[model samples]
Target: MRLDKFLKISRIIKRRTVAKDFAEGERVMVNGRIAKPSTDVKKGDILTLRIGDRETVFEILDIKDNVKAAEAKNLYRIIE
Candidate 1:
């Protein structure tokens, strides 16, 4: 799935537009390299998001076109 779409579908960023802005502004990374809104995302891929002074990292566990709020967390596993 597309990075922005995945983020929105997974409820990570809340909205697809926000996710696109985050990626276009270079606040996102995939597998250690900078990522764009259209970057491809798949199971097992690592996602790194830089927000302000903090960095959030997680691995894609699954991909779904749609998910309920309660099930969104199942799409990724945060790596601490």
Candidate 2:
């Protein structure tokens, strides 16, 4: 799935547009490399998100076009 979509579906950033902005501004990374909003994300990929002075990491567990709010957390596993 696209990085922005994945982020929204997984409830990481709450909205696709916000995720896109973060990716476009170089605040996100995939597998240790900077990634764009359109970047392809897949299972097992490591994602790093720079939020102010904190860095959050997650491992993609699954990808889906849609998911319920209760199930969103199942899409990725927090690493830190």
Candidate 3:
């Protein structure tokens, strides 16, 4: 799935546009490399999101076009 969509569907960023902007701003990385908003993300990929002075990492667990709010957390596993 697209990075932006995954972020939103997973409820990590709340909105797709915000996730796109965040990725375009170079605040996101995939597998140790900076990624764009349209980047392809798959299972097992590591994502690092820079938020101010800290970073949050997650491992993609699954991908789906749509998911219930309660099940969103199942899409990815927080690494840190």
Order the candidates by lDDT, highest first: 2, 3, 1
Question: Model 3, range 1-80, lDDT digits (tens) per residue?
Answer: 89999999999999899999999999999999999999999999999999898999999999999799999999999999
TM-scores, all models, native as reference:
0.97, 0.98, 0.98
What's the best-to-worst order under TM-score?
Answer: 2, 3, 1
lDDT of each: 0.95, 0.97, 0.96
* Candidate 2 local distance difference test against the native: 0.97
Candidate 2 per-residue lDDT, tens place, 1-80, comes to 89999999999999999999999999999999999999999999999999998999999999999799999999999999
User: Alpha-carbon error at 65 in model 1, in Å?
Assistant: 0.4
Mark the 10 consecutive residues where model 2 has the least summed lDDT. 61-70
Where does model 2 exceed 4 Å of error?
A: none
| Candidate 1 lDDT over residue span 7-41, tens digit each | 99999899999999999999999999999999999
RMSD of each: 0.6, 0.4, 0.5
1 or 2: which has the higher TM-score?
A: 2
Error of 3 at 53 (Å): 0.7
